[model samples]
Target: MSWSEACHLDRSLLSLEHFFSIPPDYAQTLTGGLTNRCWKIVTTDNKSFVWRPATHITKAFSISRFQEYQILSAIESSHLSPTAIHINDQGLLVDWIEGESLTDSLSFDSLLQTMIKIHDLDTQRLPLAPFNYTARVDHYWMLLSDEHKVPAFAEIYNRWRTAPNLADVGLSLCHFDLAGYNMVKTEQGNKVIDWEYAALADPRLDLTLSIDVMDEKPLEAVYRYCQLRGIEGVDDWVEGVLAWKPRATMMAMLWYLLAYQLWGDEQYLTQAEKLQQAFCS
Candidate 1:
């Protein structure tokens, strides 16, 4: 039987049926990021939720789906995200939150506050993966070594690598790819979706990774993050996040390339070029 067919038979996997007391009649694919195949599953009675299955997209930074499921299972009570009703090796079922995604001014204070809540979660209960930017950049560069644009990306990153960093780093739960669209502002508050790239790292590092989708500078957010948390060494935090900007930019370019390669769309290639020139020159 196909996966969907098996989903209908397995009571544990078909929690949506149990949750709503109705069987799912159809699942509609939701469009956005190229990393995962997502669906909005609606039951016969109109109850709905998201069913996202992990994909095997190589030449991109490796993502541990198992870790993602673990974090989601742990944070259901935290309310930083939609409650994960069920999770299996295939994926998880979470209520489809209804709200507008944050827009206009790119600096989302609510998103930052939600991030603070996430960072404050006890590390002992929720484990996270190590995030090393240099090593990750080198790995992606190696994967796309033949691509000329990425080499230019690597060269600029080499220059940024010389900057001094803090001797001590504050580690916390980090959503490495915090694209603005990944955040959904519901009645409950700002809930960050997508934990595929979530890990344990310098919270500042996570801030840098998020700048890809933001037009604002890191200084304001960095200062606010420090002030709210009573954190010292404000300049070091800003500098550290700034240093990771190029690496983040490079990772976006790599995703664009992969999108182009997979979909055969010229727009992806064009976007990759625009982002590459913005940083490399």
Candidate 2:
């Protein structure tokens, strides 16, 4: 069912006979994410599942859905991800992971270590695309306007394009978006969710992105994390991380701008301006 239709179903008011025969009676509502609507449903049997109704735009949303399913299936056994229960011709449904987001509670040291472990995972058994940060950044730059944001974007983009390869830097699977909001602190440890933008790329890109989202002592956290991973010559890695900041910021700005245009919310535009300021500065 579409997300809107699912949200309108009330478990308390409606008899279980009206809807599709799932074991339990449930209620759903639009929750999480800025683009797609997610419905959280609890069955009468006490089983829970999340229903993500597909968004109309095929380029971003649809492609992301397909990519997420592919990546999750490829990495399901790494012990670092959520279980993708089922995806079919209709929609995507997965087990609802319950836990607190690691956004505020995560230490920089721990996060960096987690990232290293993630990047170090063996990928020979899985078929996935290679991560080319330079190419991805170029894609974002192409979408940017030449008048207001071109020069600033080009400056940062060039640095990442030609960044030197560091020792022990190996390309492996990467969770492109590893922000606190996407991480869940479960009983087993931290489980990463929201795999839409994952790729096989430089591990440093993940570190850089996470550093951008860190509110407390970002640089210190990054350095410590690098050290723990036995990553030598951290100064070079730091440069790479800094070089990646503008591209990441601009990409986010573009997303927010697009979201604003689609949803017609001035707040998105405001947030985009703020991101631009950060990028330019």
Candidate 3:
């Protein structure tokens, strides 16, 4: 069953008997998700699952449910992410990882190791799609309104759109969002959620995004990642990540700008303005 039919704002569940043989006896809305609506469901049999319903803005944010399923399946044996139990046009259902959010508790070393493991995974057999940077950014830019499209934004877009895509090298399955908040420390281990932005891309891009989200220095993190992975010339890789830093920032700015236009959230606009100011200055 879809979100509209299965869930209600009154915290009541509808006919979920067909969705999961034994309808869930309990359901709770999980807040703090910026992109989609999420619910934690428990069936009479005591099985728990997290349900993320598809929305009109899923594509607007460059998320691919199909790719998410494939990536999860490819890495299921590694136990780095949740198991994708089921997916349809409506939404995705996965095993509920029972653990507290480890945003503050998770160490940088642990986070870096997780990134290494994900990069080392064998994804050759999976039909994973590459993250086309230009196309994706162009789509986001087009979604912005005229008033929001200032000359500064146009210049930033032109610079990044023409710059070389540093992420085209050393391709691997990269979790675009490796922030501590996206991870949960379970009894089994740290399990990462939100595979919507995951794709086959440069490992450096993953490292850059992770360090930036954690508010750590990019140069130091790059050096650590290179040392752990054992690369010959560390300087070159550092340069690549440094160059990708602004590009990553640009992508976030465009996304926030577009989100502001669609959702009319003042916070989103503020974030967009902050990024623009930082980039322009």
TM-score of each: 0.80, 0.78, 0.92
- Which sections of candidate 3 miss by over 4 Å? 1-6, 9-17, 163-168
TM-score of 1: 0.80
List, residue by residue over 1-281, the lDDT tens digit for candidate 1. Answer: 33377465443345445455555766766788567666777766777788766444522547665677778878778887766766655566777878777644335565667678888887777766567766765555555535544556556556554323655566788877665678887787777787777887788777776654665567887888778777888888887877767667766776676667666789988997888788746
Better of 1 and 3 by lDDT: 3
The per-residue C-alpha lDDT of model 1 at residue 196 equals 74
Q: Candidate 3's residue-wise lDDT over 87-143, tens digit each? A: 776667788898989878888888998888888888796796677788888989988
Candidate 3: worst 10 consecutive residues by lDDT?
Answer: 8-17
Report the C-alpha displacement of residue 121, candidate 3, in angstroms.
0.7
The order by descending lDDT is 3, 1, 2
lDDT of 2 by residue, 1-281 (tens): 43335545532222223444744455466445666666676776777766554455324432455566777777778768866766654445666788888867877667776787788777775566786555655554555455435564355456445444554456778887777777888888888877767787777677777877775455676578777877667877777666566666666666665556567789987887787677566
Q: Which regions of candidate 2 fall more than 4 Å away from where they truly are? A: 1-24, 61-63, 132-168, 216-219
Off by over 4 Å in 1: 1-22, 58-61, 103-107, 145-165
Clashes of 3: 0
Which is the better candidate, 2 or 3, if ranked by lDDT?
A: 3
Among residues 3 or more apart in sequence or in different chains, the pairs in candidate 2 whose N, CA or C atoms overlap within 3 Å are 24-44, 25-44, 131-200
lDDT of each: 0.68, 0.64, 0.80
